[model samples]
Target chain A: EPLGLGRPATPEEVAVWDIDIRPDGLGLPEGSGDVATGDGIYTEKCSACHGVFGEGAGRWPVLAGGQGSLTDARPVKTVGSYWPYLSTVFDYVHRAMPFGDAQSLTDDEVYAITAYLLYLNDEVDDDFVLSSENFAEARLPNEDGFKPDDRMEVEFPAFSEEPCMTDCKPEVEITMRAAVLDVTPEETAAKEAAEKAEAETPEPAAEEAASEATTEEAPATEEAPATEEAAAPEEAPAEAPVEVAEAPAADPAMIKAGSKVFRKCKSCHQIGAKAKNRVGPVLNGIVDGPAGAVDGFRYSKAMEAAAEEGLVWSHDELSAFLADPKGYMKGTKMSFRGVRKEEDIEALIAYLRDASE
Target chain B: QDDPAIAIKPWMQELGDGVDVSPYGMPSPYEEDVKRRTVEWLTADPVSSINFTPIHALDGTITPNGICFERHHSGVAKVDPAEHRLMINGLVDRELVFTMEDLMRFPRENHVYFLECAANSGMEWRGSQLNGVQFTHGMIHNVQYTGIPLRLLLEEAGVQAEGKWLLAEGADAAGMSRSIPMEKALDDCLVAFKMNGEALRPEQGYPVRLVVPGWEGNMWVKWLRRLEVGDQPWHHREETSKYTDLLDDGTARRFTWEMDAKSVVTSPSPQAPITHGPGPTVLTGLAWSGRGTIPRVDVTIDGGITWHEARMSGPSTPKALHRFYYDFEWDGSPLLVQSRAHDSTGYVQPTKDQLREMRGLNSIYHNNGIQTWAVDADGKAENVEIS
Candidate 1:
């Protein structure tokens, strides 16, 4: 007996959108997945940004480790160390995983990924199988680390007390200043890198000469020193950072076709000289470079791990990556849907090679 | 008598542009700088980020819809009103869906409330970090919303007796959702469609949004598409993983909903420096509380050496921004300036030390501590912490 304004929703429609799973395992679907299966799915879908071991790349979420570091300064809150419930892991992965391509995973895929994450966190054995029936059995280590908000009982009484007025303190001295620390979020790492690059090459005349040479010949020599200087701080000591490969003579038709296809990436990415990082990292010299190699540009955890695990952007690798970024690199920050046509991919690669040179 | 220069001015002699010049009105060219600005590195990208309201340049309580601070989890969704449908499901007796036209049939109410993000001054939990009031306390806006009372909608749907929690879900790309206790939903919640006498802005959830007055901004799910009644709270990603307050003891506090009383001196701050030579200075600020109305606000110019009650102005409505002003003759001396707000619940804005002592330093949300600004003799201001 309600206001008859709209029709009753069909069960099928509700089932499609009613996707949230709860802590008590209320909405879990009938599906099963094991650690081995999860590992394969995770490697194909998630490892590009989350890493092989669930160690987050760049500023994406860290999913493993940090078991007992909550009380320490700069605690790493991850799935193993911080998440209060295992259901949250399954629910989050099912609902919002792969960053941009959310809700695209099958229930079995979600279960497998969740199990793999559990294995990465060391909560599950390698042979452990996770299903709707046994999902409740997997409990998070930090299950007891949360409490209902106690602000009213613990904080309100003390904070509500009448404050002192008139000569509250004898003499006030400036204890700290924001300008001194200068840790404002507006002060970006890219700006610092640019400044450092400028400081290192103080001779303005040399910079002008290099720019002229780059424009005339698009020489690797002109760009190498600049990118190398910026990469010095982030590069590991043991491994030598790979330099961009010299481009072969450009195919004019292929480059033209690639330039047309590059429009899809131009919204989030920039290229050529004077291109700065935008929503996505600058694509200059990215064709043959290692994954997650851009200086001052934060990459997803999976991308960082892939780079750490020796992921070089060769032609076949780039083709596969561009074909299905999420499917190939899981958890990557890149949101672009793959170029469907094979020709578009080849043309894009050719354009990038020519443009980088 | 008119001055000779003004009488012979070009604008005075010639006709100005007609209405045909602009199909839609815009802010004057001189007011171009008065805009929402974001701290670029605050988030991964602009799409899933927040922008600060230009509180430094604004006066009065009502914030214009154009310049209100925007927070988006998956960017602004362009939802067509014709295609939008609000569904009420779960524990309700009848699962109902309403079109925009069907929703307009219900009796509506107009209420002015200040929607503040829980992390408005979250950065200043350690100390005075952001140099400007806009950056420190700009994640808030007071707007007159026109909508139907949530209680009416829930009653129309006929909520089952067992339902204690309602999960409000948005239609945006993130599908932002939050669990609300039935008590709060019945009290002051609104399924709003219009703001400031016009259809909601696309950035502000154009078709419809849930307006949980006085609660955190995230709870006001934009492009609100569904409400699911349940027996218990849904510890979703936003609730458990993101919004929860982590403490130093390795424990976190969850569902800490209500925002405490807070205030800040807007003018004569870093961005809105005192350009004129020091004479009669009017120190004005905004104070609000989620619990109730701000009954009083105390201003301290000598770093709490002396406190004076500022004069409260306009309607002192519950859960709305209350403007206060303190006029005084300036002595042209360097001084530490601060404002402390006290709500009707007898809650005074605590100092940074007191808040840190209670909740610890790890929390990234709910830092409603008293803000301090140091003004130099040159009429310039800087963010500083006093000992």
Candidate 2:
């Protein structure tokens, strides 16, 4: 008040972002959703990645059935097994869910999904309906499994005393060697090339390390940045965080022209750092790439047949396909009528070649 | 006898680049390898993944603005500082929203601190999985930040007596949220905007970020947009299911906010081997403690058998990284080196074996265990766990 800073926020303004939910169920919106309703929504929006049974497809989080497994050597932390509060599921889904598409679900849809998640974990029956009034009745398996941090009381005193500088131990032997495990992959030649090119000039924050950025399957939510996806589900960072430091060198005029040609394909296709398999396979390296090369992406039968026939997407092949999608390959999934202008097709091809790198 | 190489150097015959080139400067072309890199398999997608800092090649306490490791839920939110707003609501006398300009009107202070991801060095828990020190200890960065204390903003909103908890939320699509206790929120926490005397890098929350000094980086929410005061902890997804340390006994520790004392040797590690054939080599590393300042760091060439006190270098700031070095003569033999940090709180860094005995192998977050680098006769180093 003394500084005369910051005006009073309107009630409507506060309501827009105050979406946090607490353990005591203080912020549950007035809505209801049944288990059956949640099942459909989950199948449509989540099962592509989370799996139909919540067993988790690929590296996505398992939403159910990890009870009693916390003490295992490799514990599977799931919504049913590890999460402590039901509010977390509700709040996280409402705020960030369905991966690329977030905050699009309604309150009832989020409730329904929460109910179905409870059912999948066997905490609730198939016919159970979750509502604000009865939300308190539902309890998670790990509700009492949590306690406050006790390191200060327990570990500090033992670690505090002056430690011995000499003769602290009798012997030292190698228990584990990273070379023996050989999990860390060797840096590739392409990366060295990319780095060299990037060093010469700055690209417009267009991330290029797709293989390192997205191709590999990985388990996440280890509690920090690679840290906290958890059972709360999706943490799809806004778009791709600007990997501003690294980018392949290319003509600015060409890249700008290439972006215009890209808008036509942007709806179904994704490129660059944020690219993920959606309606269409990511076309990052599609210009000269092999047909149906993207990992974890399902290709059309025709495309698969073409791939089986050793069809690489050379310049000619792409030009032909772009000119007439239906004529070039019957049963092709791409619905675009095709780029009629020859210059536009060439520019588009040029763009794809550079965009993917 | 003069060296022929120096006389025939290209610099003597050719002119170098002029100042007109590269409007915004970048590291020299020779230093291309000195940049952030990510382990692809660490996360499912780049958008929600994390990259490691090149700590092996870096020196000093301050992490360069460009090379700081990034951890994002929904990638980076490219926010325009002029258009961004910070809202303070819930349990406050009057809900308020402050623009970037309005925040500037208030007084600000500058401080240096380190932000270490709770999952820093997490992969090493199972054993030495990553060969490079960049992979093992790169999930942390220390820098100077300028901003207003969070207490100032809370005071402006007039906090209510019952408001025991504060929920910090990000504007990123994931809408990342974390709950902080009132005691910590009002003490030393800053609503920081500038890092290293410049506006924050886009990936590092450009407009503003909550700086929870001495706390886990996750609680220092980035792209910070809202602060909602409440009566109790929210028990959000990040707090309960993610950041919490899961013990082998099936019980987990929630609100483990502070990063325990941790230290790691940077040079003569896997990435930065003893290229000079092991003579007159200097072993250097970084140490820090969330409880307070790291006053001492001990280095051991023969693993834990014997440790000599390392000379602490750089400005020793509380809750910030302290650089330490040990100069010694190497006889070109196999060596196992490790560093132990002693914080102002008198807490000595624990060994991997010691930590495993207390917390078990499953606690991925807050390993803080001593790391060992085994250098062979060839002066090539490898990441290895010593027993």
Candidate 3:
């Protein structure tokens, strides 16, 4: 007899959570949707992050294209080119999709999205409908590409040998240097630049003030002003105090609403005292500041040109920019679709003003 | 000036803050920098993102619970242990469910194992891409776990003869799930409830998690809610779309579960570069294997020109991290340092070129290649690749 510890899980309880679809077409819900339906759903639900036509937005996973690119120098391993099974597409979309919102799509929507993704990859026609019955028939182009683990047979034999000792190579030459490549984080670069600047020039008064300002201000604000002047052969310490004093006042409710709206931007931009630069520049004091003025942050050419044109991030300018970042500044590197709601933008501006300061 | 040794220091002269000050103790404020960090650009959102353990800043085998590397498909589930239930059904003679209290009744065992994400060193596949060890090889942690063997629980339910696979699912929003072979489920798999002698941290599945020792971290479903006995593999999104390793020829490799033998020199690496002028230095590292135990580890100083067997110390348990060290007098000359781990299965860690030759550069997971660190004359170490 069993210990009878827990009661039996009800069928309905199991059905709701048993959402996995296997490679052999098991666990798929009964539903049908065509590529046309999927196209609309993908645009409405996915395109904000996963670009139109499955090309991917920013660092989001690409859902289609890149057929036969697995062997390329920079292989784009999208669904059609890399994934081995069609069921995987259905499974992934059903389980985790739309970035933050997961498992929100219906069975028909998942089916349609899967069908549309196939069409985007050129694996199916626009009229092709995908359902539980015909799901396995729509095989991926790389269906036979996958095999079971064979590292023991293929890799272990060679690597298992005792590694060499003494004279493995004749003369080791430094082919590539990390410093020359300069892929290290901005903080390391700034620290090295500051050290070099201190070593070269013994300007105690200015450098002392810069260092003091760094410890006093937000850490993210430390790098740009101190190292920018330090890297260059000039002592421009006057701007540091002014930028530090640029904190803006805001109402609590507006800032609160803006914080909620800022969730959309949180994926790329980080703000606050401990915020470090991520995919986007730290949104510390962008409000009422010069365009593209965040220190050590590489801005798009369009933004640099806008800054050259004497554009400042005034409330109106920020509202315009937040409304349409790319539309306002053509060639802007920001991949986000601007905030559609006016209230959200206003709240975001208030939040950026209050929170960053 | 008077000697500080003779002069009474503030701590010696006065009583310190009482133990009740913290109630629950924390690491000293001075050790604030010892934290898990993430490369922000790696994933779409922080909820589904992974953070790296600060292996460079840590010593010894067990990683502190606070600083353990966290990987969440749907963020950490705040599971109330009292409300949590572990249900065992599907292909079972008698389906059973266990509350947290009921689960505690099962005889538990304590074991130490290293949970490594298959994608731990996946970033460095192209060529010494990430400069820091934290980014390159920090998606792993070793912790002592207290749990009931999954086989014991399965036996309690009495799995039917046809049952060949067990689907482990989480209570997270993503409902992360994976199919474990029946043999593995009955072998060493554990339904762990506690880690490092304390309740499992919320990020590490609070109430319960499946600890599939030596397998990829994803298979260890956190906030584990259910176990379904089945006849076939689920081939779910995680197994089919994500965890599967795509090779150069476009073919992908599935069920690449066992984490191969791998090692990395922790100290004198990018983040923990040598600050003191070269003299007597102890080069230490961590090595582990999913297939079995690590028998030995070798440290190379001159880019394989010389290899010294590192002295294995601390717990050398199977599937657990084995700390290794090589004491050497540093002469301040430029050197290319590397470590090679030899596991119990007579398998040695493969080089990047060898891995590329076999699996190709298209893979985003299961990269157990030997890492190289170029130490310049100034004692700064940089990630580098050698032909």
Candidate 4:
């Protein structure tokens, strides 16, 4: 047996336990109570806290109509739908009800109220008697819902099982495939060979063609699709000169430092290979990138509308957004308070700009 | 410090900077050494597996409000003390209502007792594999409590002749509840309101709790809110499903409440490895019982080959910590050291083999067998079980 003697109880301890209600309902006393009595009692005393019909007022528990809804998204639970035994209704209502003014009800009142609850749950008809004699017969709808787990029977044996010893499964081979890489062994080798061949053959002509196309085109317009005429007259500016060579490749130390700063953004954002959307958008190659670019991920309507407004992610815009996320994009779900440290902000922006390429 | 007039810091400032209300308070910074000694990386889930108090780091008969260890089947309830209420109805002649304040009107008493979890020494049932005294003897705590005797309030409202049990419930969102036999209630049970010399800490049932000293800690509900007197036990989940231990024969030992006689050597054990060489060694720890005061503690060297009575120190109060020390000269030879306690009822702590044979090695909690610390020639100790 678990240890200790049945020690003598003190007056206070005895008093606390003195409140317990019994199975046989022996402590049940004189006075008659019924569903009708409970309905009026509930409306005046309970409906303010518990909703009318016991669906729950707010954070308070719903007391009715949760019958068979335990698995629903918003389970309509109440004393009727969830409680497994009627004894609980008597015990709980008798002990704790009317929120703060507990232990105030007479035995008849508690009995009548319990009958009313049974009526509400559709378990007992209004004509049913909830007295001590018939109370034990009142089983809850969720009675079978709970049972001692059989896990101990199965689990204890496994836990006590002799673990793997010498020469265990020597013939085992790696049969499981990586889910994310999107490659089979043969396909990976073929792709690598093709990439090597393609890399050796420079795509300078294609690169020049694309640059020429860029020079001829204007930036995307406010309209969802830019008109052909919008791209006509910007060719000369694009051809002007490749002056101010791409900002010097960021320092490795600076990138490392910036990565540390990136931790600050991590609670709300994700980056790197295989990054998925968190509270905020993934930042894969986001520098100088098109706005609202990640495919299939939902962006706030504000950001999508920003994209329609021809708002590409320029260096200045990225800096402004980083400085104040909520201010830059109203209605964004990001709850992050803005970064206060300038040095951290600078380092982060530098890291993002370099990593984006 | 003697001037009871110590400057009281604002409640908000007294806590950590940027005062975070942790739903439950934590141990003070001065008690950093006292914490639930946890096994790092032992289990994948922290929400499930947890440890207990560092009994070795604590002093005084009472476990301080914060350092009292906790165990949760689900999780700790984040209850607001102000919003708490306790109701008493059911089998009573008249349903009695009492707020936390209403409970204060009744008489109160101060007691020194130990509240131990049934799973206190559970992990060491198989062998003395843990290397820390904190790990082996850290699950239990002894304390001086102040509360109202339960019998008074029960009598105030008056219990009917048919009332045989009382169902105590908590105001927690979990609505934790338990059933106590009326006999136990009228015995030495207390509705405690204070611990040590101050108001109860929120973690240790701030406003009110049922203090059935020497009983399993779980039954002493925290943030207690309701009490329903009845004719029979409720067979609540805590009583029927979890707290009840199933024996090898499939029958369960139900409603096992009293913590049996147990003892442990806190220092110079594995965690407190021998820093001093071949000189004097002080082996110290705590011993207690739910039945009565611990009267004696015997130390065994060379694997119980011989026994020596250790000197008992501190208050040997009933149901409270009885610190004992065995001091001896070491010759730098490898030694198998162990300690055994004898309670007032003359029940002696049993050996590992005896306990294992009786309870088997299947339980994850409550194996209070004598612990052995193996001292090597180098004067360092490691936890080892003797065959």
Model 4 ranges off by over 4 Å: A1-357, B1-31, B39-50
For B163-272, candidate 3 gives per-residue lDDT tens digits of: 99999999888788899999999999999999999999999999899999999999999999989898998877777667887777767788999999999999889888
- Per-candidate iRMS values, in order, are 8.8, 2.6, 7.1, 19.5
**Total backbone clashes of model 4?**
48
Write model 2 residue lDDT over B78-133, tens digit each, in one string.
89888898999999998999999998888999999999999998887767778898
lDDT of 1 by residue, B1-387 (tens): 877775567876799998869886789999987888886535546777788998988888999999999998778989989999998889988888889999999889999999999888876766666678888899999999999999988988889999999999888778788999999999999999999989899999989999998888989999999899999888887787777788989998889888888998998787788777778998889999999999999998898889999999888999999999999888889878899999999988998888888878767788888888898998899888888
Better of 1 and 3 by TM-score: 1
Better of 3 and 4 by DockQ: 3
C-alpha root-mean-square deviation, each candidate: 11.3, 14.4, 12.9, 21.1
Give the alpha-carbon lDDT of every model: 0.81, 0.84, 0.80, 0.63
Q: Which ranking of candidates, highest TM-score first? A: 2, 1, 3, 4
Residue lDDT tens for model 4, B1-387: 387556565863565456556645676678565566564322223333445677666554557666677654334556665666666676665465566666666768888888887766654554443556665566677778888888877776678899988888876533557888899899988988888877776666768888887777878888887777877778654554345543343333556676767787777665566777888887777888877898888776676666778899888877777888888888888887777877776566766676555545443445667787777787676666665
lDDT of 4 by residue, A242-299 (tens): 1322448665566667777777666446665546664357887787788887886556
Q: Is 2 or 4 the stronger prediction by lDDT?
A: 2
- Where does model 3 sit among the CAPRI classes? incorrect
Clashes of 3: 3
What does the lDDT read for residue B222 in candidate 4? 81
The regions of model 1 sitting more than 4 angstroms off are A48-52, A183-357, B1-8
Residues A8-119, candidate 3: write the lDDT tens digits: 6677776766677778877878999997789789889998767676766655666766676767645566678877788878887887776567888999999999998887
Kindly give the stretch of ten consecutive residues in candidate 3 chain A with the minimal lDDT sum. A218-227
Q: lDDT by residue for model 1 over A281-300, one digit each (tens)?
A: 88878888888998977676
Candidate 1: deviation at residue B381, Å?
1.2
